[model samples]
Target: MSRQTNKLTATAVKSAKPTDKPVKMADGGGLYLEVRASGGKYWRMKYRFAGKEKLLAIGTYPEISLADARKAREKAKERLSEGVDPSMAKQLERKLGQQVAANTFQLVAQEWLERVHQHDVVPDHYQRNRRRLERDAFPVLGKRPLSEISAAELLACLRRIEDRGHVETAHRVKALCGQVFRYGISTGRAERDPTPDLRGALRPHRSQHFAALTEPSAVAELLRAIDGYGGQPVTIAALQIAPMVFTRPGELRQARWSDIDLDNALWSFTASKTDQPLLVPLPSQAVAILRDLYGLTGRSEYVFPGARSHKRPMSNVAIKAALDRMGFKGQMTAHGFRAMARTILAERLGYPPEYIEQQLAHAVRDSNGRAYNRTQFLEQRREMLQRWADYLDELRQAHPSSSQSSAQ
Candidate 1:
């Protein structure tokens, strides 16, 4: 039973002041008033449970008064009588309170993003996931608790995005939502992943290949249009190199000078999609472009730094906007350069499929079942890339404005 004697008074608690050392006064039962040298007051209870001593924090004084502390002591005594350790009970309460606060879908999803980033997942993947959450998931389910969210509600949120003609985005959102739910479950904020129930619920997503102009005449016209682009010299250089190399726009924009070896005439970096190191054999034309850009942006890290600041790479919108200016708005994507090069190099240039695939960094396997390593066909790739650049020059020369390429 809790000791009924009371030794602390409201007036004494008000008069307590900081000292050189902490002072703790007993109030009876196991409750006491602790005064710190920093002038902080805390209420605590000490008790024995199952042959072990434990401490339970009642609260701060003034917030929890002399009378309330006794009531709390009595409550703890009752718990101890029922074979429950007061300290363990208090810890459980705290954990439950934290779980309650973090139960919301938004909170759980943010936590999931932090874990993804901690494991070195790509920043673009995180940003895209965040965007989908804000657009489709957050408005409807952000504030709702993960345990309380039904599969139907999540499906509705995804269906809304699908209804707007973004089936792929909708499916991606569902997968991410599942990831967040699983994260929450591991953290004790959710019960089960609701995404399993959503299989076949969303409309089937058909992947669309990037529209590209593969014909020699079309590529020539596109080259002429890019050459006449009224933009910064940096953008013109990026546009010129886009067709000359089989690299994704993201890789090109984020290109670092440290990753380029002008002496070796090679650009090497780890590709984000495959998480594999790739060596891009720089052709003479590409090397010339980089050398000229060196004079302008050599000090900066990014080859195509943004116009306003050199700290960041140029925005993907810059490329899209330039393509729009060239009147190939929807007809070409920044990724279309890959398809264009693939088709032309294979069909027109008469390069071997293996050589082209290796240069493109596709996940092709060799006869020995080993994955194509970065330097698998280095010398052959070096020859093929230079040939590809020369072929592009040949195609450009067929245009009426070809002489301007020589003059410029």
Candidate 2:
């Protein structure tokens, strides 16, 4: 401790030179000022708490006047005497100040993604939310703090998405922002969310359904045309089996060589659409196609390997394009094969509805009914597939001067 220089006035304080003895100024209470040996003066407060003495620096001399320094030091001492650790108290105050400064919409949005979005959301919702955030929210409010984001700024972002003819997407983005803001509020990062004000700001969007073929005869004609496609062998095989099996285009295209057992007449595949392992019993015609395809593609992993990249499966558009080449563009789609099979197997073939649904890999209501394993009707399906193949053969036989005849 140094001697106090309470006698020094403001003028004397300015003139004070470097000395061993420090000049002291009273800042009220136990706080005092000391002029250092280097002529720079600083505020120092001394207090005893919890059986230990603690020294705290309030501020530098004229930069923080004696009066203010003394007041600050006294406040700290008062807190210390009240069973509070002033050092811990100061650290908490600093942390709170930093949080307040960082409490922007952007910060809260990121926090929401890191905390809630990644864990609580389903895989599809997680991916959709991430895409929405990247395409809409990040471009505008990503760098802006949550507290600084006004309703006008948020509206501008939503309007931008709406202008691109994505009104529904814009509405979803706004709703997601509201969720992020609420998360921020719960986590003590924001006081209020501004996204609620944008409810009616965006234009409503009209819903559109996918165009699909549903008629039985039309579907049969489409299948006949696909069977006559004289494109690549892999394309022909895919088109031939796609209708017969009626699986999703992805599942059909991504069929692997290892999953098929020709001797057992089974086509096992991990279905991407259902996320379940499926076992499809191969019909005699399907087995013949696979046997031919195996001789060509068995060396690789994929049943239909891409021409440009053997490691990857053939493109989804390949089958549809082959169908187009066969002149059945609008009359059929890749998915139309499902309608064809469902209608024919249920109506013309007179197969049970449950068997048809099970073969289609559709979820059935009756669990107590015979298991829906596609292989259950293996023998019947083989017969049915051969009959369908024979029908297609007859169609080609009838069209003597067909485009496929020239190609073949």
Best by lDDT: 1
lDDT of candidates 1 onward, in order: 0.86, 0.71
Provide the RMSD of all predictions against the true structure, rounded to 1 decimal. 6.5, 8.1
In model 2, the worst 10-residue window by lDDT is 399-408
Task: Return the top candidate by TM-score.
Answer: 1
Steric clash pairs (candidate 2): 5-24, 104-145, 104-146, 105-145, 105-146
User: 1-408 in candidate 2: lDDT tens per residue?
Assistant: 764434335675566577787676554455667777777888777777688887776678688865566567667867977888666777888897787667766667777887788666434456678889987998898877776778999999988998998888988898899998889778776778887776677797676432345544444456556666678887888877776667777778878888888898888865554444567777677788889888888898899988788788898688777766777767667776777667656666577876666566666446676445535666766666666656555544454445343222
Stretches of model 2 off by over 4 angstroms after superposition: 1-133, 136-163, 167-224, 227-230, 367-408
Superposed Cα deviation of residue 56, candidate 2 (Å): 8.4
Give the C-alpha miss distance for residue 301 in model 1, angstroms: 1.1
Evaluate model 2: give its TM-score: 0.58
Instruction: Estimate the TM-score of every prediction.
Output: 0.73, 0.58
**Candidate 1 on 1-408: residue-level lDDT in tens?**
755668888888889887999999888888899999988899998888888887899999889988888899999999989999988898899997787767899988887787664355455656777888887898999988889999999998998899998889998889889889998888888889989998899889999888788777778888879989889999999999988886888888889999999989999987766778889999999998899999999999899999999988988778777888889988887889999999988877788888888877788788888889899888998998898888888777775555434322
